[model samples]
Target: MSLIGKEIGEFKVQSFVNNEFKEVTKEGVLGKWAVFFFYPADFTFVCPTELEDLADKYEDFKKIGCEIYSVSCDTHFVHKAWHDVSKTIKKIQYPMLADPTGTLARDFDVMIEENGLAERGSFIINPEGKIVAYEVIAGNVGRNADELFRRVQASQFVAEHGDEVCPAKWKPGAETLKPSLNLVGLL
Candidate 1:
């Protein structure tokens, strides 16, 4: 049941970005690197901090040709209101996707049926719209964008060099292991 290598399904939602509202679809995520961050609610305690951290690293993500999308069950109007009132969230230039109907959460399989909210989910997708990495955690736990950036780099390295695989704690310009029978049981 792993979502790895699974293409994003059809789903469209309202997104608030750059003081405007727009519709985002599964097709919209194609042809570019993207991150889908799912959180419980907008005005909660930990969400803003995590979002601000991502915002701080937004430019670095962009440098790697990645786009960030923050999703919640809240409506787009709520996203706008939070964007207006919260200075930390206001720093986010990425789109805030509104999933009031829980469709996106369900599509990502992070929805809590009883709570009508989503868990802390982080998904890294490649240019072809396939999910490359994903993590879902409890609502209280936050995520690190720097780690996500590293994962993205590692994914890109692996994609471009299919013969090579990134080792633990791999960074760009670092050494990658070539998978071959001769190297088996040597490490």
Candidate 2:
């Protein structure tokens, strides 16, 4: 089943952010753009590199009214511990959501049932709490924050301009395709 256009279910989880622990809920994520970035685990190879890359672009995401939430099945304490020991994790200013119970992982359909771990998933949610775009990649593969940012930009543009569709490699101020009414019968 596709999660696109699907509204997220209710969830409340603890997060480690800015040297403190706070609660984040589905309600809190509403009324704004959000990115839920799921990884296999913390303190593992490739995860930090991807996370650090996101950290580098955190401000850009924020500037565009988007919030980044990095999620793992690890506990908040584990998140804080890793942040303390690793300089790469320390660079992260966004929330590190703890999905110890797998509520979030299961909700997003990224859960690995046998291992109690999540795959590498990136979800872009709109202000209405519905998923607008998402991608799930192999555990060994890392994703690009720049591409994710571009996707968010595209999604936002398409939402606002319902008649136009973004083209390949679409960026702000780039041309968008407006489907012609006469083309419907050609297909």
Candidate 3:
């Protein structure tokens, strides 16, 4: 089933951020835009590259009132350990959510049962805790943070405008299409 417009269930997990362990919960995630970025595992190839890319754009996401949470089935301790050892992971300022129990992985429908890991999934959630946009791809493929950032911008724009839709390669301040009966024939 599609997770779009579906409200997220209650969850509370330990997160590694700012050289410390913190608690993140559904209540904390509510009332703001959030991105739940699920990866296969920590201390692996491709994952760090993607995470480092996001780290570079973390401030941009925050400027637009969105928070990014990178999740893996690994424990919070593992997250911290990796952060300490890897320069790429050390650059990350966003929260690294530990889903060791697979609660979050299952909730996001990205869990790999046999492997006890998550697939590559990116979810954009609105202030109301409902998913607005999501993409789940093969584990071997890496995602683009810039594209994800653009998507978040598009999602926010559509949410506020309601009547207008973003066109291909749409950016903020670019023209948006307002659906109407007059345009039905064009499609």
Candidates in order have lDDT scores of: 0.92, 0.96, 0.96
lDDT of predicted model 3: 0.96
How well is each residue in 43-149 modelled by candidate 1, as lDDT tens digits? 99999999999999999999989999999999999999999999998999999999999998998899998999999999999999889999999887889988988
Q: Quote model 1's TM-score.
A: 0.95
Off by over 4 Å in 1: 182-187
Worst 10 residues of 3 by lDDT: 178-187
> Each model's TM-score, in the order given?
0.95, 0.97, 0.96
Tens-place lDDT digits, model 2, residues 1-187: 8999999999999999999999999999999999999999999999999999999999999999999999999999999999999989999999999999999999999999999999999999999999999999999999999999999999999999988889889999999988898973553
Ten contiguous residues with the weakest lDDT in model 1:
178-187
Order of models, best lDDT first: 2, 3, 1
Q: Candidate order by TM-score, highest to lowest? A: 2, 3, 1
